[model samples]
Target: MRVRQAKRDQLVAEGVTPYPVTVPTTHSLAQVRADWGHLAAGAESGAEVAVAGRVIFVRNTGKLCFATLQAGDGTQLQVMLSAAVVGADDLGRWKSLVDLGDHVFVRGEVIASRRGELSVMADSWRMASKALRPLPVLHKELSEEQRVRRRYVDLIVRPEARQMVRDRAAVTRAIREVMHARGYLEVETPTLQTVHGGANARPFITHLNAFDLPVTLRIALELHLKRAVVGGIDRVYEIGRIFRNEGIDSSHSPEFTMLEAYEAYGDQESMAELTRELVLAAADALGSRQVAHEQETIDLDAPWSWLPFYDGLSVALGENVSTSTGSDRLRELGKEHGLDLDDDFGPQKMAMELFEALVEPGLIQPTFVCDYPAIAQPLARPHRSSPGLIEAWDLIIGGTERATAFSELIDPQIQRQRLVEQSAAAAAGDEEAMAIDEDFLQALEQGAPPMGGLGLGIDRVMMLLTGAGIRETILFPFVRPQV
Candidate 1:
């Protein structure tokens, strides 16, 4: 209420218009400051420059004062002001009106101060937008939780946080550019689905008042993109948000972006090669083949290792988890890992959990684990030689699962049976289990061609590239309500 009242008072005192016209911006603070040192010696004068930024800090030294402002490109610049330079006519007016946290535009000449600091000498200035309440001040005394909660304030003061955001943006751009270069068409899939049947993750449920139906937020883009591939839309991808009803930790979020792609006539091997290429391209854009996160440096340029899922299981379990082992052996292995191998626990579920508990996190470097059990990958095609294994590969990086890809199963009979099995799992109180999508199965029956598909976590990739922890990479990460 106080903030609202202050905003109203500001408008009244300044005689600000109800609707303000647009102002054109010339250059960013970064472009100006990058050459500030060289230009300060023989600074340009009498040049009209329009700069706009949110005022972060303000300090007055009698008749002279200084304020630091943050521009759009995350660049901070100090602006110096004196009563004499502002003019006696407007000095009193400026002194009465100027406040911290306000967005202002200044038309000025680039110049150097007495202390050899670069600054913009104002010829004319106007408030673009007024910030009613003072923001949290810049100081070294703030706590970590306070800083994380008030990230906008932290971005103004912390260079590392600002750089992390910038780097994340760059990596996102690099991904799109690489996909576009490879002739992949960017597409949008539905966020709300009647039957959410992609991937193994519980979804956030919502209701549609208009349709009088309950819908679930998409947990993955795989099912729909594969449908498109069946419709003859080759080489397509979607960088979209997926919602999962899951526990939050350093690596998990309820809502996050997934970059999923599908290519016609390709297989898991092709997808793995593409994943490596795309990651390497992003690493090059980051200007380093390696990225630091915590105490470890992930070598992105290093040759990615490819190992069969069975081989990885053998290494971890001390026993071979072959398809020929039948359900009894798989159940025993699950029991050894403290996993409940129930009646619904088929070869796929048992093998998947075994991988998660054993082999997944052990992959500290970039490695692709392939030949997942067909039971584990319902939508993936089975390998010709290994009847029990699907042509699937999951790219694990820095002890985390980065991406999952596979050769899509287009045989309508096989797809139906897999969906039926998945439906049974969902019926058995497994919320993360996939639901049978008759529409998808119908599309497959329409003679969908064999294709390769990939789903990569964009958030995790950004986390790796920016060398920031999971919470740091994401802006506005969900937090529980404080009472």
Candidate 2:
């Protein structure tokens, strides 16, 4: 670091700008390769082009110097600096001042070396940005802790890191395309909410100084998007951040992106179809529907299976299970399955815990586990045929719940009753219970159409598409503070 600083001081002493205002570039390194990559050995294209990138590699052999420039998209271009072309004085300055991590600009003719390696033969070069600290060794792998803490460095050193960013963008773009194509209007909602009731998750709360009221970061995008449906935007969707004051793990993050959409007059089946299309679209964007995750190949192209929630739980437990089952019996089943069930947990909660433990892990393919118990999803309408089940489905992909949809409970009276129950749970110390939002209830009272709402975890989708962990999918995921 001291050596690089001394070089910067030397450049200042020489009346040279270590950090220039602007270094014009005519082509990206990728563009340069595409345009002149066909040149024969010892061939020069006679076309002068300006390009700039971080210097990742350098080798000096007195009169001849070679440096590799890498662009943001991980494209590498070799620049050949000859004393004959750049002049001896300039060549010496390049050798002395240019470091591996520094950003530099080069104006050069397209050429191929005697060995037919495509390169830019530099006529002139300048320091675009000087780096005081050296980069990590090119071939050394960064530890997981270091990779998340210093993502910028990870992006620079690991091609896979850069590719993950591109893949996430591609996945988001594909989601928007599918939504727009289906006539869904994209919208944004308040991030700081007076009441957070969208999903059953604890929220991060803060005090709003202007209103002198307590506010919470939104835990889900469902409520307002549904309100949009009530306001006559028949199709609405939002791909935005959701904060959950929850535990962190390989599959869970406190902060992550979510895609929530609502379609008026649609039911759980319609939303399920949309979910399938969206997942396939994202998979297509990543160039394949077949994904390898955790020693399993998930074929998104194949027909996704449907498992009725209670039936799946029953199969897993080797006994019949339903909403009518006693809470004590469910607890016994949970204990048998190695689940540490809470004493306050109701039958529905116990059933859900058992399903998550025994059934969810085996759902390796794209599967829609439908018709959950009413208490499991307070916002879903009652199932038409099943007495105590709700019309809802959780899309599980690669053994993870990637998306969920509900035949929305638009009946204001029923919605209120459900929220009342949830509110009671919240008061009784359930941190993950939904609060009664009077405004949302009023909106429903004003008459909302029977809509199907879907919420997909964008980070989990990226995880499935890229076969990366949740933290890798989120560019700057939350990390523990270093003491």
In TM-score terms, which candidate is top? Answer: 2
Q: Per-residue lDDT tens digits of candidate 2, residues 372-449?
A: 988778999999898999999999987899999999999999999999999999999989999999999999999999
What is the per-residue lDDT of model 1 for residues 1-483, given as tens digits with 9 covering 90 to 100?
Answer: 365356547667668741247556676677667655565454554455667788877776667777777875667777766777787555554455667777777767777666666678776666677665566655654576665677777776677778878777888899999899989999999998999987888988999999999999998988888888888888999999889999988788888888999999888888888898888877887898887755477787778899898899888989866766667788887787777676666676677778888888778789998888876678888887787788888888877888999888889998898888778888988888899898988888888877889988888888777656677887777777667
Candidate 2: segments with Cα more than 4 A from true spot:
none
What is the lDDT, from 0 to 100, of the residue 20 in candidate 1? 43
Models, CA RMSD each:
3.1, 1.3
| Model 2 clash number | 0
How many angstroms is residue 83 displaced in model 1 relative to the true structure, after the best TM-score fit? Answer: 2.2
Model 2: how far residue 157 lies from native, Å: 1.2
The whole-model lDDT of each prediction reads: 0.79, 0.92
My TM-score estimates for the predictions, one after another, are 0.89, 0.98
Steric clash pairs (candidate 2): none
